[model samples]
Target: YRELLLRQRINEAAQAVMVAYAMGGDLDQLAANYNVKRLTVTPADNDAVPPVAAVMESDEALRLRVPAAFEGLSVAGPTAAYEFH
Candidate 1:
């Protein structure tokens, strides 16, 4: 718990530094101008977008042990309660 809190504080501090740098504040000059240590970041080699939709579970992949007639019915209201002739 103690270590997690310390890591969270460090992360928040880094985020603040990033926000300041984004608002036209010089990162390298922060130490000399404001007497603060500038946060350094190295860009990753592969900055590709992740294929999230490809690995998501589809409707067909849902596992239910119910009958076929009760498959897509919603039991929340009286509209689905009527039986078909």
Candidate 2:
């Protein structure tokens, strides 16, 4: 059961990554959450592979074709309500 739970958690994290890939230009919040890290993005800018969240939010055409899950995980910026990112 513990293994199953871990698998589920891993899958959830993967889904989150997919979501981030959708949004365009790699917003800081989405990338951090999906990767389970505090802002460790590579390239400093969009390169061959952009951040998951960045791909989805982007209206502009992306070089790579991201998935629909990207549309779902639109992790908001630091909430003004709680002042948390």
Sequence-dependent TM-score of model 1: 0.24
Model 1: lDDT to the true structure:
0.37
Q: Residue 79 error for model 1, in Å?
A: 61
**What lDDT, from 0 to 1, does candidate 2 have?**
0.40
**Reference-based TM-score of each model:** 0.24, 0.26
Per-residue accuracy of model 2 over 21-71 as CA lDDT, tens digit each: 434334334444433223233334445374444323232222121332244
How far residue 78's Cα lies from its native spot in candidate 1, in Å, is 66
Candidate 1, residue 81: lDDT: 33
Worst lDDT window (10 residues) for model 1?
58-67
Best by lDDT: 2
Evaluated with TM-score, which candidate comes out highest? 2
Per-candidate local distance difference test: 0.37, 0.40
State residue 16's C-alpha deviation in candidate 1, in Å.
0.4
Model 2 scores worst on lDDT over the 10 consecutive residues at 56-65
Residue-level lDDT tens digits of model 1 in 1-85: 9999999888766754552322223333333333333222333344457522223222222111112224225465443334310
